[model samples]
Target: MKTSFDTFISEFQQTDNPDEKYTLIEQIISSLAIIPYGHKNLTKSEMIAHKVFVILRDYVIINQLRQKHAEDTSSQKVLLNVSLLFMNLCNNINETNITVFKSLFIHKPLIDELANCLHEISTHGKYLNDPSRLRSVSSLLIALQKIRKHNFTALEYSLIAPILFSVTQCLCSSYALDMIKSLERNFIQELDEVQMLFLYAMPLYVKWYWDYCDPEYFVKILRILLNDFTAWFTSCQPESYLQRSSQIDAMIRHLNYFLVRPTEFDSMNIFSEEFYDDYCKLVLHWSSILSSILACSSCTMNVKLAARTSVQILYNLTLHLNVLNFMKTIPSFILMLLKVTDLDHDEVQLNAYRCLGKIMIEADIKTMTKPSKIAAVYIAFLKDTIDDSKKTERFYSLLESLKSKFLSIVFFYD
Candidate 1:
């Protein structure tokens, strides 16, 4: 007897009625759900399973071709159901079933079709009027992301950014949030080693959609993403170190907008009091991570140096904004800055001094005047840099300004 998957697809292909075809497609997907639960070990019985998926896969390609002219509701339903079935297989594939899942390779036409359908309906507001269509389209894209063998080229990945933009643009904030959660859920659960390339594509995706997404919703999405990234960074395997670092660097490049102009974001209620509260907490959290990395002796010199530089950048922003009260508690970061002040790289040294200067200008007189605190560093930094005039003017100017403030305070006290 043929496998249940084979039997269903055969009957599914015979049906010309869209409703009947949709029902059969649903049954086919329901039957495949057993693969993820480990009940169907397709690896051992790969031949039969491969046959089933190949037929199903080809059926999808043919219907996708037909779907172009399929304007009636019934035809739309059948085409959508078939598309969902393919996505379901992608999402539900596991180690045991991956061999069978590989049948989806080279389905670029079908992939493009699904993306186009999603964007066309979404851009035109079809999904908005019918919530189910929105969910189905979103679900289809989420599912397609799971197919490891269908690696998207950079050009194809670029197509994804606009689809994401269109979807988020047309949906309400609540539904947009739902769609984001589904995409994230699939990224977390459905992706495996072979599928990790998509992770690199994500930063580009976020960058493209950043300006288009509603600030309110984007910030929430960003927070969740930040938390996930931190967790990934902290527990990451060695193999992923470079990829994770690149992703973090790309993401921070965009986050600078919020860090640089909190007021602009606040005007839109993007940085409202509630978000600012969360913002302060997240800054502190990342501060601790950077400090730990800087302090860890076993870490590579390059990594430690990078972390030190990031600390300077973070403190410079926080101190200048004066938004987070907890910045004062992280005094250890001051010494890290002083240590990097002696580095060979001019920009790094400049950033270190700038950060220290900000901290000193913001510190209370007592903190500034302590023997080993700003006073001692200020004197040494100024003395050590007396001969280096290459862009050293800015450093001296900042130092002189801070010293003047500190001296005025002391003269008043005396």
Candidate 2:
């Protein structure tokens, strides 16, 4: 039986129309849909797969990057090539071909080279101020994102700075983040809540999967956004600035905006049956990180830092705490200061109560005069009450201490 290899190649070469090529590729892909398990032909499959991906990788703009370069936004060529190659490989092996796609990235020089190309995206955006090039860079980065299934490495972080600075400056992250979350809500199934959370960080998650994420990443961005808020507050009229603030009182307005919201999951529908059983265990590890931040917040004397950052400080503190979970930490954090290691009882009480007092109301005003005018005075008044009451008049002092706590609650809630 003579089989015509020319006939097969002829039909493929005839697909001159891009859409037709893609359609033919899809037909090839549909043939590869099967699940596999047990011992497998990884070596043979990997060898062919590597060659396929290597040929595909060749199409990846094979020039040493130069400064004035423009990023290629058209990934469909290589993307289609990989998809077609992947489907054929999968049909022969009886498994999804994601592992084969990943092997190309796992090869060291290739990873470094890919990262280097991405670095061009970063550099071009920064020095050139080319937003289109930046967008194209992101498109390529995102395709690698698909190949790696959104995974990354610590080394690629430098490549992110250009895109991050660009996107943060632009007004599109809000929309982009929401689109990512909507996809997470609908299609991201295999992940449990925790894996899903890593998935939810959107652009950031891409960095995280690659091991590029640092908790400080968010902290740095928060600081920049806070500065924007401060600058706007300083320049604009008081009523208008307050009304038009980007972050309310300098705290993250949406706690889980890019993370999981309550709707995509329910505690009753928790991904883990062990969640409730291990609730205390999870809190134990999380609280250690929380405690250190609260301590730093306590020791810092920068009044502007405290006044401006208080909302965010408390906002973060409350994050891991659902109503019940929140209550569990308070006793420890508060009671730590309340510790009777016999440090001056009155003095400790005065300091602890004072920290709690600021938790209620701290000035948001940028002007010195505003914090001093009754707004500042109200805060000082609470301090004085805590001080005097901690000393002599036991009955009056208790009453004053109670007053401060109640007053704080009123302002915080109102």
Candidate 3:
């Protein structure tokens, strides 16, 4: 009366030997692979799937505990097989089996263990070129993606922090990229949502690991964020509105942190010259991206809001002396700010002009060759300010401050 599933579970539980457990897990994976998608019968199928998931989850937890003492090759093989089994189960998940799947795997202990396994595999240079590790990592990421899909709340900041750090570390290797690309090609065809999942979690990731991650790591993270933002902006999917906003906000706020130079009162700060240089380069790159977004005549109102927010951050950067000096080095960056001043959006134009005023105050008049052109832009901006009846008195005050600075420059030029 024993089904093959029952028999496999019995053998899997009885085996103390890793190799035997690995074989049984492989058999279980192979057997699960044949289960037809969307079968009508629920009771028997759910019970069987639940038992398999529990067995694999238990084995992974035990193996993880054992791994603390020593590295076992046999144990790693079994772990890879277990991950493969989880991937197979994830593929077969449906409304019928989803509850069972979430119940067994969405717990913090299991997620932490899986993250630990991924961290171990990803951080080791020896595993970089190993096909088994690649498969294991891909399977683990798919499993995590399923968990993320089913219960995003379960992946709170604490649980997800290590996973994000590990994945970022893994991405340093070309092998990991190949593995992720393979996953994208084989499983999820639309886009690399797995990578986007990481990017989406970036606000949390940076919050938790900012002090720990190196400047180069942050540079890499920012680059990925910008690239994803560009893609999302171009495609402009209706559903991805929140995603785009979150990414834009995260990038802008993260950049905002660099604008505030660390003072002697700040004991916990990790500010360094190298980090400053990286921030300067990122600001220049982000300026170019923002210019394109603002210049796009067809961009949405939401995109305009994002650009305005970014311009405000850029203006904030010009307030800091060191960052302002770095900003002054890039004349094209200055021109981008000036060009933004000509845009129709009031807040964006105001912020861009504020940024320009800051630059003009510190920068020598000769560096800005077109003094008349600059004066014309300021005059037009001041005229627009006077025409708006709803314009706050604060605007008038700021205009006068900038006006005096520009007048001094014009006098020197004359």
- Listed in order, each prediction's TM-score against the native is 0.37, 0.31, 0.39
- Weakest 10 consecutive residues of candidate 1 by summed lDDT: 186-195
lDDT of 2 by residue, 1-414 (tens): 012223333555676775564454444333323323222543255444633235334433232123244444333343433433443343343225455555553554544543554444333333224433333333444444444433334444454444334433321233333222333222112322222221222233243232233434444333323233223223323222122223222212232222211111212133222223233333232334334334443333332232223222232233333523443445564444223111323333343343344333234212112122223334554566554422223334334444554344434443
Q: Compared to the true structure, candidate 1 yields what TM-score?
A: 0.37
Candidate 2, residue 113: Cα displacement in angstroms equals 3.8
Which candidate has the top score in lDDT? 3
The lDDT values for all models are 0.46, 0.35, 0.53
CA displacement after TM-score superposition, residue 381 of candidate 1 (Å): 20
TM-score for candidate 2, please give it. Answer: 0.31
lDDT of 3 by residue, 162-236 (tens): 665665665444433433333221211233333333332323334334434455555554343333333333333
lDDT of 2 at 253: 24
Off by over 4 Å in 3: 14-20, 37-45, 60-81, 92-97, 120-126, 154-157, 171-220, 224-414
Candidate 1 lDDT for residue 400? 47
Query: TM-score-based ranking, best first?
Result: 3, 1, 2
Q: After superposition, how far is residue 232 of candidate 3 from its true place, in Å?
A: 19
For model 1, the stretches where C-alpha displacement exceeds 4 angstroms are 1-164, 167-214, 220-269, 296-301, 312-322, 362-414
Highest TM-score against the true fold, candidate = 3
